[model samples]
Each structure stands twice: as structure tokens, then as C-alpha cells.
Target: TLAPSAAPAASASPAPSTTASPAPTQATDPAAAAAAPPASVVAQYTALTCAPSDVRRSAASTDKAQDWIAACDRDGTTKYLLMPASVVGTDVKTASAGLQGGGGTTSINTGQWVVNVEFTGSGQGKFTRLTEQTIGKQVAIVLDGVVQSAPQTNERIAGTAQISGSFNQSDAEDLSNVLRYGALPLAFERSQAESISPTLGRDSLHGGLLAGGIGLLLVIAYSFLYYRAMGIVVVASLVVSGGIIYASVVLLGSAIGFTLTLAGIAGLIVSIGVTADSFVVYFERIKDEVQAGRTVRVAADRAWPAARRTMLAADTVSFLAAAVLYVLSIGSVRGFAFTLGLSTLSDVLIMFIFTRPLVALLVRRRLFSVSRFSGLSPKMIGGRAAAVPVATTRARLAKRPTPAGQKRES
Candidate 1:
């Protein structure tokens, strides 16, 4: 895999050509771009401007002795590199025949990022001869009419050669991938392209919204049926959470180009379950305290500490999964992950700032004491009926007749 730089350049190298004209340099370091204006005066690029060419032009040039062609450097600069335009040495029809592959790595000796390019058995001989002719001169590796790299030929290489320059990790990897896969990795034939009609797009949006609404209604119906009057808390919390999520989505769309697609609506529907689970956890905990003989008011407050921990744990896991998916995925999947994560966070806020306090307040009301209305009432939660106060029992004993004479002495 390691070949010393003694080989000559091939009459033509294995770099692939693009069908369209080459584009200007695409990648640049922000810091370098920022400092470029002041340094422009000292820097210079001398290659003459030349018209672009494709594989046909490159193959035609190979019959001639040499043709000077100018191509933009891949580096983040305005300079152009000049070289002989030919894909001659490699099989012209299949440009990759002479090349094996390439990759980016840190040189063990120099400790700098570099790209390693390997050649096929036949390409080795041709490359050796080309390098001999261009020794000490820069040989530009042309891909898509642009110069990927213009490495100075040092010596004759046998099978592999290293392209070394001032490169960051991303730059090195990009060059490596380009070499590994030809300029056009897959041959694509020309085809007609059309956009979906606006009416079709609108129908898709309506369908997604309708599905989400139906799911939400089912959850709300279940909450009302099971919790009765106490279900209002669940409904209120959801409303508040939905409001916050809506505002966030609108603000983010304006700020960061976030478009809510159908996949995102699916994510929102899934979040409904997550939010409902939080309510169920909290409500169940309160019922447990009520079943243990606590009043609705006492149970509401006492159950919170334990309920909060459970809710937090569940939301944390949910948020982490969403975050990981968002980071690892692309396209519409990312949209789903982002919405799920956002809703998870909103659930935490509603649980703490809204739901917990609301329950605490509501449990103190007379409405909550009514078994028929508040599903959290002791009898409703499968606990014993509410008993009279201990104070009232003591007063009744005091008021009893003095037949038991000892009671009057006090």
C-alpha cells in the first residue's frame, strides 16, 4: 500500500471526468475566508484561464503531445492549476480500470493528513513513465474538469502514491472519496423531471392533519371516560403543551427553515402517547396514596415526589432516543426526531410548571371531594369511605352523659 514517490506520471492518469462543466471550489474554512481579504495582495495564481472540457475532450487530447489546460484548485483559494489534459494511460472508456482506490490518513512519518491513491498492475508501469517525464513539476489530478490536487512529483512510485498538502481532516476525506468513487459513481441517463401539483401537496397536508386529529380525540375520550372530572387536568396540560409546541414550531420555521412535513405530524401523534403516559403515571401514583387511606388533598401532594421522579426518568429516556435519532439520521427522519424531542421537553415543562401545581390546587376543591365527580375520591380509587375527623370523635365522647362519673370530673 506504500509506494515511494519515484514513479513517473502516466501519459494519462485515472482521474474521472464529469459530464457537466466543472464548478468553482465548494469548500472553505470560515476562518481562512475571514482572513483572505487582507492577504489577497501577497498571494498570486499564474495559470492562464482555459475553457472547460469533459471525457471526450480529455480522450481527444491524449493523441496530441501535450495540451495546457487550466483548472480551479480544490483548495479554498481563487488560484488555478495548469496540467496536461488527458485520461489516456487508464482505459479511456472505463476510467477506473487503472485505479484501485484511495483513502485519507495521517502519515506516520510526517504526522500530517494526506490522501493515498493506489493503481492497478498495468497502471503502475504507465504511471512510472509519466512521473519520470514530469519529475519536479506539479501534476494536477483532474476530476470533473477541476483539479482535485496538484502534487509535485518527487520520485518514481511503484503502486501507491501519497498526495500531501496543507489539508484538514474533512478536506482529506473529501478528496479520498472522490478518488475512491469515480466522478460519476453511477451512470444516470437523462430523464424528464416534474414537480407534484400544489393541489396534491395540499391534500397530503390535510390527510396528515386529519389523522393526527383522530388520534388525539381517541386519547381525550379515554381520559374523560376513565378519570371523569379529574380528566380536565389531563386535557388542560395537553392543551398548554400543544400551544407551546405550536409556537416553537412557528418560531423555528421562521428562524431556521423548519418545515413540518407529514413525517413530523406522525412524530407529533407519537408524542401524544408520551404525554399521556406522564399523566397516567402521576394519576396512578395519586390513586395509590388514596388507596393507602390518605385524603384527596394529602394524596395529591404526597404522591408528587415519587411521581415526578418516574416522569423525569421516562422523559429523559425519550428525549435521549430522539436526540440520537436526530443526530444520526437525515432527510425526513430527522424531522421526525426533532419534533419528538421537542415534545418530550415540552412534557417535562408541563409536568412541573403546569400539571403538578394544577392537581395540587384542584384536590383542595369541594368538586374533588365528590366521588361521582372526582375520580380521585377515596371510594373511587378503591379505598375505604371517608371517615369522620378524630377531633369530632373526641368531642362526642366529652359530650356523653355523666353516667360514667369519671368523665365529668375533668
Candidate 2:
């Protein structure tokens, strides 16, 4: 019985060896095993699961998924994703290539693309149609062969549709700027650039203010030295002009987003010079007339027209130059141009309103006209003939014979 058991065990051992040999043979044929269809592939073929039931449906029948995806890809990876219909709030049509539509020419440029779509009087209809048609379709917005966006329409849009994808804020801003500014009649080109840091700009403003203050002080000192008591008129005029300019700058800053840079400060300082020059011209003209033997009041009146003409001519040239520079330049140069123009305009306004009116008022005062300290007295006019003296009523009475009786009575 034991020998028979041993024979059976020996036969089982050969079976184990046969199984071990097949394992090695299979290990050597790994490439062949890998070439065989995977279990997952076999299962896929044999079993059929339900399709994804969660596909998002668009409100608009034409809203297609493919259009959105294309738009997203075109916009790059960083832009805010937005739907077109939401932005335009109107109906849009799917235009064929080179189709001219009602909105404008559907054109493509190197940096951007245009989608030309025709909108009905009820833009909603066109939007609905576009949304319905583009559903699940890759609708591309092409600009000069570069696709801006290709968004899949998820719903039928009742209004205008927008597809935004990977655009940066700058890109969106630039696009918006183009849309808004392109319709304007004016043309512009960059002519210069000067980058000024905030710190540097502040320092410049400080220095400019210091210089302007010194200049103003010198002007006031000279006015007092030369014009004496009447110099108050010059100071008052300057104050009024300064106030007007300050209010204007503040209001402009609020209204038009105007900024006051260092260059602008320079412009203001220069305007001070212009304002002073106006005063000097008027004063000198008045003095010359007085030296020619005219009364102060007469001289002031006579000098106005000539002074006005001269002021107009000078301001006109300054303003024109500023305008040209503003139109032709960019960046810091623009700041300079803006300041120059503003100063020129303020100069004109001050000359007309504050300076002329104040001077006219001063001339009407007897003290200003007669006092030597007022700088307008005829006696102040060097080498000029003196005013003729007339006898007073008192002097005439004293010379009369009745005056002796009045003296005895006193």
C-alpha cells in the first residue's frame, strides 16, 4: 500500500513541474499577452450602460455646447468666461464667411476677430435663432484667422450672445476700448513717452510749488515797490485767478478724470508767468499813456483795447502750440501739453474777468488816480507836465473885498 501511495505522489509531482514550465513560457510571452484586448475593452464591448443623463440643456434651442468650448479655447486660458447673449442682449445671426451684415462690416484683423451677424428689429429673434443653431456646435469668432472664441451654445439665447474664453482683463479692456473709441471721428497717434514714478512726480511737484511761491513773492514785492498802494489790485487779481484755476483743476479731475502730474504743475507755474505778463503789459501801457500826458483814468481806458489785442495774440499762439502738442504726443508729453493748454486758457479768462475788471475799478477811485503812492498820479509820470492849478472858491472869496469884512467879524 505504501509503494502504491508513493507512485501516485510521484505522478502528482510531474503535474506540478508541467504547470511550472507553462508559467515560465507565459512570463517570456508578456508582449503577446499585452497585445491581447484588455478586460476593460472586452467588458465595454459586452456591456452597454445608459448614456450620461446629466447633459446641461440650454434655454435657447440653438445653444450648442461646441460653440462655448471653441470660444473658451480661443480666449486663451485666463479670460473670464461669459456668454454672448448675456452681454449683447440682442439676437445674433450666424454669418457665413465675408458676409456683410447690418451691424457693420464683419471684418477680421491681426490681433482680433469680428463676428458679423444680422439682427432683426427684434434682436431677440436673431438671438434665439443663433442660440438654437449653435447648440452643441463649436461656433468660432474669427478675427484675421485667429479665433477669439468658440463657445458651445448651451441654450437658445433670446437676445445678443457673447462668448468669452481665455482673454485677460487687458484683452477685454482693449476690445471694449476699440468698440467705443472706433466710432469717434478723431484720430490719434502716439508721439512720445516719459514714465514718471509716483515718488519722483511728488518731488517734482514739491519743487515746482517752491519755485512758483518764490516767483510769486518776487512779483508781489516788485508790484509793491513799483505800483505802491495800487499794487493791491495786482495781488487781488492774482488771488482771483489762482482761485479760478484751482477750482477748474479740481472739477476737471472729478468730471473728466483729469490728473495733475508734475508737468501739469509746471504748466500752472508757467501760467503764473503769463498772468503776471498780462498785468505788466496793461500796467506799462497805462504808464506810457500817463507819461504821454494823459490822466490815469484816461490812460487806463485808452490802453485797454491795445492791451487786449496783444494778450489775445500771445494767448492764441500759446494755446495753439499746446493743442498741437496734446494731439501729437503721448505719456508725459501729454501731461505737459495738458498743463500748457489749461494755463493758456486760464490766462485768457483771468485777463478778461479778474485782471481787467479789477484794474478798471481801481482807476475809478480818486485815491488811485490822485495819490502819488497809488502809482497812477500825474506827478508820478517823470518829465510829464503838471496838471493846471485852478483857484478854489475859498481863495477867490479871500481875494474879494467882502472877505475883509468876514475877517473882522471872525
Candidate 3:
């Protein structure tokens, strides 16, 4: 269990060190001290304050004789700092003996970011007592020989200690990470950076575009072979949709710096099926009307309402799925979802603006009236011939015929 002894007097000296090299008594220049560096990663908190000039004068004193250690401020708010030797009584290793989980978050009261550190229930009394003794003094939290912070103790704290400062979100998070995972063993040094070749990226882009192109060709081939003369409308609608999507991608890339990744291309490729399904619904509905013995012109108009509802339902499902994925995911997956949702919306617009109106105008042409030319022919779609109701009239039979029959109804 983690425990803390009572605070020693402010003037008391530190215990004898057992390490190979003794800690420096003073750092006259922060830059020079940073350059030479120490071999220790110890974190210390002290409650005494010393003037920068005073610490410099005591640099040559022995460990026992020196009463102050000079440190640099972490955030550069202060260039030099000093603290008494005795109050470095509790290092991080000792203070964190009963550390529980903690994290960085914003304060609800002030809306300022802060780090909340929690200690186990057993360490609650020890922390409370430590804060009480250090009240009204600055607690210098020194790490890697730099003063990370020197927060003043206003009152006694209990189980949880909130470290609040002029911290932005990122700063608070970084400090919390350091607290959770202790200091690094080695210091950072300058190193060379390597650049990656773009050959693989080019190959991947080529493969993705090739695959999408193949898929588009297959959809177009099937539409022509199945929909007959009506296939022209599908091809026309696809051309227009592709144009719109290309323009939008270019505009978005320029405006928002959107990059069309491989996943995004896949989304556009999948949208081929979505656009195909829309026209297929309309075409099949027309065939259904024709099967019920309606002319092509009449069927085109009559089939619209049902086909419209079905297409709306299908696109609605696709758009909702894309929206959910985009919201819940990150990185490439979000790019995929964004493109898919965009394509779905474009599909709906093309159906209303291009496909539907084109069919309406085409069905009025004399060429569409011919069963052999129009894909909605009765024979092709198995439309039944319209039945004609025959009227019957009462008639009188000849007398000779009645005699021959010998039993004619009067």
C-alpha cells in the first residue's frame, strides 16, 4: 500500500542519496543544464521557494550543505525556479503508491480543462494530510529536472486532486498521459526521417479505378441485354449521374481538401447497382402494367406511383445506413460512407430529373407504339389480350325447324 509520512520542517535537509551520481544542487542557465542533462527521471514535489539568484550562488555547495535546487519552468512562463531541498520529501514513486485510474477532462463549473488524479481509498488520508501541511505554499512538481508545474495549495484535498491551469484540451490530455504512464527512461534526440515511394500508391489507385470501370461495364451490359430498347434510358441516366458525381468530387476536393481514397471509389462503384436498381424498378413496373393489358403509353404513366414508392424506400434504406456508418466510424470508412450517401442522393435526383421525364417523353413517340420495338410489348411481358363483352338479343325460330326438333322450347 502507498503511504506518506508527516511533512518535515521547511528548513530540514534531505536524506543521503544512494545513487552513483548526486543530483545537481543548482542549474544557473536553463539551456546549459538542459544540454548537459541528468541520468535520472525522478519526479519530486517540494513546498519551498528560493530566489533564482540565491540558488546560483549555492551551486558549489555539497549535497548536505545545499538547501535549494534550481529548475526550468515547463511552459516557459518562468525561465528559472528554485525550491528547498527538504520538501522534496515525496517523489512520484511514493506519491503514486495508491494511484487509481484518472484522466483529463474539462471542469463543469468553469469550462476550463483540467486533469483529475484519483488515489485509492487507503491513500485518501495521507493525501489529505499532505495538502494540509503544504497549504498556502507552491507545490513544485518537478519531472526530468524541469518544473512541470508549481500549483499553489489553497486548501486540503482528499481522494481526488484536480490540477487546473491555463491548459488547453491537448495540454491537459498530454499531462494526463504522462501521469498514467510514467516518465520515459531515455531522452529524445534528433534523427533522420525517411520518405516513402509513391509507386505503391499509384498501383493501388490504378487497380481500384480498373475494378470500378469493370463493374460499370457489367451493369451497362446487363441493362442493355435485359431491358432491350429501354436500356438507352439506363445508359443515359448513368452518364449524367457520373458527370455530376465527378464534378462534385472535384469541387469538394478543391474546397474542403477531400481526398477520394480507394474506399471512396468502392462506394461510387457500389452506387452503380443503386442507380441500376432505380431504373430497373421503373421498367419492371411498366412491364407489370403491360401484362395487365395496358398500352405502353398508359402503362408508363400508370406504373409511376408504385415504382416511385419502391425506389424511395430502397434509397432511403441506403442513405440511412451510410449516414450511421459515417457518424460511427473514422478514417477511410468515413470516406466510404460519405461517398455512398452522396451517390444515393444523386441516384434519387437522376431518377426524378432524368430517367422519369425521359421515359415520359419517349413513350409518346410513334416508335414506342410498335410492340416489336418497345421493350414493354405484351408478348415479351406476357400481357393478356383485353376481353370484349358480347351482347345477346332475343330471336324467334322458324316453325319447320321446331317440328323437326319435335321438342322445342316455347
Return the top candidate by lDDT.
Answer: 1
Q: In model 3, which regions exceed 4 Å deviation? A: 1-91, 94-182, 185-195, 383-410
The TM-score between candidate 1 and the true structure equals 0.54
Worst 10 residues of 1 by lDDT: 18-27
Q: Model 3 over residues 237-343: C-alpha lDDT tens digits?
A: 99999999999999999999999998999899999999989988999999888777778899999999999999999999999999999999999999999999999
| Candidate 2: residue 73 lDDT (0-100) | 19
Off by over 4 Å in 2: 1-200, 383-410
Indicate the residue-level lDDT of 202 in model 1: 86
Tens digits of per-residue lDDT, candidate 2, 19-56, equal: 00000000101232224433543443233221122111
Local distance difference test scores for all models: 0.62, 0.52, 0.61
Off by over 4 Å in 1: 1-188, 191-195, 383-410
TM-score of each: 0.54, 0.48, 0.56
Instruction: Please report the candidate that would top TM-score against the real structure.
Output: 3
Candidate that beats the other on lDDT, 1 or 3, i.e. the better one: 1
